[model samples]
Target chain A: MAVALAALIQDPAAPPARHIAVGAASPIPAAACWLVRKAGANVRLSLLHKRRGNPFTEGTRELFDLAGQGRIDLFFLGGGQIDGQANINLIGTGDWPGSKVRFPGSFGSAFMYMMVPRTILFREEHSPRVFVPRVDIVSAPGISAPGVYRRGTAQALVTGKCVFGFDPARARFRLVSVHPGETAASVRAATGFDYDEPATVEDTPDPSAEQLALLRGAVCDEMLETYPEFCRRVWQREAQERVA
Target chain B: MDLLQLDALASLVLDGATVALPPDNSLPSCALVRALIRAGRKNLHLIGVPVSGYASDLLIGAGCVASIETSGVTLGEAGAAPRFVAALAAGTITVLDATCPAMHTMLQAAEKGVPFMPLRGIIGSDILAHRPDWKVIDNPFAPEIDPIVLLPALRPGFALFHAEMADTHGNVYVGRRRELATIAHASNRVLVTVEQVVDFDLLDDERLAPGTIGGAYVDHVAIAQRGAWPIGLPGCYDFDAAHFAEYARMARTDAGFQAYLQRYVYSDAALAAAE
Candidate 1:
């Protein structure tokens, strides 16, 4: 997922990520951003989760203020529920206040989704429950009407199973690629929504030798402080090892 | 400026007042929060600046909150705020869901002494549907039918936080967390707890002036060293992840949450251990 997200960050179809902001509890996206930066991209990264040397002194409000004026070129967002139309639900399931099951309330997605020019919808978990046909609530709509002051829409939706490129014009998602172990059929079965798929979908490219090396070396080092658990789980690197 | 004790500072917050607090990453005065819980304060409405974290969650777990208005509530890396979720599930508290910028915008409006302020996006979100106070209207300046959401001003009754230090002049040095300035500006009263009380005025330094909230806005200052303990003060201490993991583990159920309150929130020995 990190490799896939890194590729999307560098995708030339969208605006250059001159300044990208990553929000809290987003280790994978943070890792992907670090991967792209370490791989020689000229992107300025503002990581909100960075414990030290944080970029924003004015608080998270500064990040939003910058995005409001169209300074942040790219951002990453995820949802407890994402729909075929690219709508996301961070609020949770059930009634108005999510009485049955409450996911964390929507953070900055409501504004950032419209303020920033590009957003990559990422959720590592891929299944019928998550990739629902219709979201319980629209925390942020994927497509706004023509007159609405929307700067952008979801560029792409990357999941553990596959990648779905979003079309704002049609408010739909199209299957782009599947992971190595997964097939198009498997993706279709797991997905609750209907999406256009090619007859022969390509397998997501594995991270190259250089990319793998960078992910383990410098990226792990950069992430150790903010995401010790992720590093330990994915790269088998311990936080104490950095101290040692 | 006179420095008050922790309990005296906590006493300024009357029951059922709307209080604004920064999230865990920023400086949340956990020490003051503990004092409030111990005082058995109830029916408090908390605004999580833009979101909630350890301070908000602990307050919810102890049944001290009647309502919470914020973007989200979580323990960050540790996981979902178990007590907050449990309270919501049990229908114990009113949840006023808001997006991050909306909360910031509402407070910014209050800072400007405006009735409301316009914000882009949230037009199609259900959050707008729930927030009747948030109005949508055609952009008067637009040539076409451009729509925008207008959020009403939210001036919290009290703005509470922990800072690295406060000086004799009463200006609290927040460093980069200037959103606290917005909170201080918007709220009716500003209460701050600091790690130290220096003899000199903070505004004497040019570099520090931009980051410090003026003494004029601050209503009270209390000296509580390690005021943001458990949730660290930026540049002063790192957050205790082991403690957070332990709290998360113990806060999963009502009984466990009670046990946690007994051990940490009410127990002075545990508080001393944290020191």
Candidate 2:
């Protein structure tokens, strides 16, 4: 929610008609509510840094209503894998002991893919396991066909290494930019699919002056500075997981 | 006594047996299902399970159950799996809003021959109000009325289930979150129908699910192909869309439901087996 709050404040498309509703597979109502307010982004805020829980309560219906009524700006979803055109596949497997690990995920992925015009795909983990060739299942749709989007929806795929925005003209993921400390070749090598290696995938635009100002003054110091306990519980589990 | 023979799988439930049922929820289907439905007696109960489809509506209409004791979630009820909404509305089914775990606990108490089991972090105020049948005695220590909800045990004559595959000797392997465990614990006798009867050696470590119900617990098992009929397995067949919609429509009226039972369930067993 802190990051969502900050993302909203800094959004070039602030005061959006859709009101930047935060959709999650888990409950983060407070954080979701915070995104509507203007206080958080007063620094560079990254949503990935936060620890969250299972908020899965069929929240897809809310988004469905918004889409049916033509009231959506950007819906963000995190996936386990994404390909050239930003199609996601959250269902795991292609190997041994794989059947056991189907992460409970967005039941509305199919609906969202067809409806929400603009979607942001975030893959928290960046490795071969994700970033696959074609997905095991078509969890979300991207530029499946040219002019497929009757409404103007963009699906920007963000990974731990880089951020790739889609281009319907090519009907593939044209590199809009890369995150700090990433190279196009490394990302290309890691991908499971075939795509033209761009001459140079540009660096991801730095957080704007306004966004930075908001993050430092209003967001980082005032909020996230606290909540050490929630953060600890998460990383502690993660550490134990690593050891086990 | 171990009668879960492959050749007799179809005849086990359909040929003759008492059965307990959950309204609107489902267990896997078996191949000789149509014959079973035709041959099956009319004496059903509305217990609780997670999902229900055409088979449930047919069974209920067929009059295969006479009693009911329920506390389990339905498909479309609060925070439920969104599949069985229509069946719920059609009244061919019955369910109350409660967790499957709670239902299991209540039914298990019945199987263990208890009056009512007392313990809870549940019994929301709203749920307590609707269950007029449940009694609330004194808490004794608490000043307030006994805040606990008393779930009477449900001892069904027998429970039935279906699965992907089994062996000649009636070992059942179900997919995840299945009610097989609860069924095993709750029934006076248990019957099963499975897709294929694999060789005994095929029950490998990888193939076996964690909560495997023992043969000691199972009274009967029968092997059949396409056992999960009528109700499509998620990844298997495309659902029988027309049948579902038809059941939803017909189950609305008592006459329509009775007609359905006569045509689909209470027919001549000899003709049904031939058909």
Candidate 3:
């Protein structure tokens, strides 16, 4: 999943990303950014959660200032609920002031979604519940109406099941590819919003042997500083093997 | 330099005052929070710099906060902040939902002694729509450029936090957590609890001078060892994972939350009295 996300980030059609910033509590994105750096992409990787790796001395204030100045090329965001129009809800489920279920409050999701040119919406769980017809609350609307100053919107949404390419022009998602085990029909059944899809969907390319080795080796090691627990749970064997 | 008892330091915050707390996973002044809870402070408006977790939840659960202004309040790896979730769901406390940079920018304005700070990147968000205090206006410098949102300055009545060490001169050595310095400069009163008080001047060391905040900004200092317990102090200790897990488990319901307060908070008071 991290390798695939990295590939999306490195795609030439996207912005020539010179600098990428990963948010707090997002290990996968952090891993992806590290992988891109290891792959010799000439990208400046900034992980907000990293203890020693963070370049900013003043904290996230610098990150926000840079993004506002259009320095950040790619950023990642996730939501409790994401709708067809690309509206994300980080607030909670149900109405305002009276929510049925509450997730964490919107930290920088809305701000980064507006300022960063390419914001990828990545949610591991892709079900009817998560991909709603319309988010209960619009923490950050994917498509701003004319006259609202918005530099960007959702570029793509990568979930566990499949990757959906967002068309800002049409304001809809287009089925790109399904993961190894999942079928197109299964992806459709899981998603609640309407999207454009071809008759046949291709399988997302598996990571090359070199990519896997890099991920299991240097990438995993670099991730230890920010995501020690995650690395312990996922790449324990690789880390142990390196130690031996 | 003024050194006050924990009770007197906590009393610096009166009812209906807007207070700013540090962000999640930093030094949260846990000892001071307990003192406030014991003193029964009420109607306080709490501001979380970007995010808040344990301290915010504990205060809301204890009914000490009338309103909360923050990005999010979660216990991080321990999971949902149960008391905070319940408070929002029940609509018991007024919530002014804000994004991370918005809070920082507002506080930065206060630090700069500016009436308002113009920030980019909130023009299309629901956060901008919800905050009537935030305004979007055309750029005076470049009329052709896109409009930007301006955030009013957030001048907190008090900046309450915990640090690793403070010297006899009341200068705090916060190391790389410089945001604490910003919070102190932004607020009218800065009260800090530290693990220890040193006799030597902290600024005398060239290595630590850049990270040290001068005594002028700090109004009061108290020595409270393990002051940020449960919430980790950067280099001092790790978060009490088991205790946080227990908090997440027990704070699910109102009765359970109150029981938690009675056990940890008041019980500590009782133990202190006995001692």
Candidate 4:
């Protein structure tokens, strides 16, 4: 129950006058939604609507507001595939033939990469397959700083095991930090291409008691409680099947 | 909350609707299914967009009372679920079409309670034969409209959603325009479970979730947190992988399901949790 997001802050006390946190908010939008709840100051979300193909339908305007004013400072995203330059391919890479892989689409990754001052990319699976060097496509550019991108694009990358930085100097992704149990080699094993600096990745801090409490107790209880019903149809159905 | 008490909730589905899930999932500890089961109902169905990780598969298996199915793929991207894939491979279950975009149309149609939907001609090549359930019905009423492909509706008698929070009477917080609401709206009745009740104005004073679901639509309102487990509850916790995997394995066989129910569900634990 350690503080999963404390490290997300740059200056906890005198936080940057401006910043943004764009949450993926998928699988269960609530996962990223919870993170935004903690980092509320400069955060925006790319919410999936009740209907697909109807973009910007639900809260599209709010997203426009957050990015429109450069209110968001950081972007956090996670999916199945990520390549060097931080191009992500959540769409299929291996299984599909000419059709290729399919993702939830880029969602607001394209916009966030341009609008947010800093962006961080993370992967749930820190394996070699998911961590590619060059992505199949650019969901969002990692080092899209000036001339390269429309300027003002991604700044950093984070994963379950480590952290990475975008070196505007070299115009590429560079390993910045690693979590406690991870190693540079293991981290690289998951990544696809070569980033700039191989030597200087640091370690992410452990989750704090306060962070854990906030994560568990501070959520909106009304909605949080109903999740079991979701599983009842999925997990419990099978649980009962195994019994009778 | 203690997860062991979850089966109390699982025992509620109509008899045939019970789908023994894979062993690799968590068994919820609540009353959602308890109410469903006691009614001795069946004809369970599932159709929604997609969840990020394992929630969709988990729900497709457990939440469904009669048959386990969905409209989209969640194998990281667009594709059939492993259960569906393997079922198609072994011929345990009949797979209609492996296309996702087309299925999205079907889900949209079903959600809208429509007879058929016009697709993007994706079925012209390979998927038409794959899906025996779908039919190309011509529209005599409108000659301009492409001969329509009608996918049957997957209408679950009820849809259950877990939200960020809900007012005591049950208007879901629209933190995002979510697929859950669509599923609920598409179905006959909705059951809404939330994290907890704020003073209503105590949070979302502007009514962030104002029109998401009317109080009348939601049959019941539950207040709980860490409610979306094995499914992932945002910052609260990552998915419970071990539990999820365990459920997946146990549910691989029909006999295994009976054994599961006799052990965990029929016990006093389920009865107590229900109480």
* Best candidate according to lDDT: 1
The alpha-carbon lDDT assigned to residue A77 of candidate 1 equals 94
**For each of the candidates, what fraction of the native contacts does it recover?**
0.87, 0.00, 0.67, 0.05
Off by over 4 Å in 3: A51-53, A209-217, A232-244, B268-275
In order, the first chain's TM-score in every candidate is 0.97, 0.63, 0.95, 0.67
For residues B14-110, write the lDDT of model 4, one tens digit per residue.
Answer: 4444221111112121234433443344445433332222433333333333233422334331223434333333433322223333434444576
Q: What fraction of the native interface does candidate 2 get right in terms of contacts?
A: 0.00
| Separate DockQ for every predicted complex | 0.84, 0.02, 0.60, 0.05
Tens-digit lDDT string for candidate 2 (B99-206) = 333455566676678888653323322234445655555566776554444568766656766666655545666544245556666787777766666677324556
DockQ: which is higher, 1 or 4? 1
Model 2 chain A: ten consecutive residues of lowest lDDT: A51-60
Native-referenced Cα lDDT, model 2: 0.47
Best candidate, TM-score-wise? 1
Per-residue CA lDDT of model 1 for B1-275, tens digit only, reads 66888889899898998999999888889999998998889999999989999999999888899999999999988899999999988889989999999999999999999999999889989999999899999999988898999999999999999999999888999998878899999999999999988888789989888999999999999988878989878777888888999999999988998998998877878567334
Sort by TM-score, best first. Answer: 1, 3, 4, 2
Write one digit per residue (lDDT tens) for candidate 3, span A1-244. 7877898898889878899999877878888888888888899887776655357777567888889899999999988899998988888888763278888888888788988999988999989999999888878889886766778888899899998999999999999999999999999999999999999998989988988888788888887655666777777742234532
TM per candidate: 0.98, 0.43, 0.93, 0.44
Clashes of each: 1, 35, 0, 88
- Residue B82 C-alpha lDDT in model 2: 21
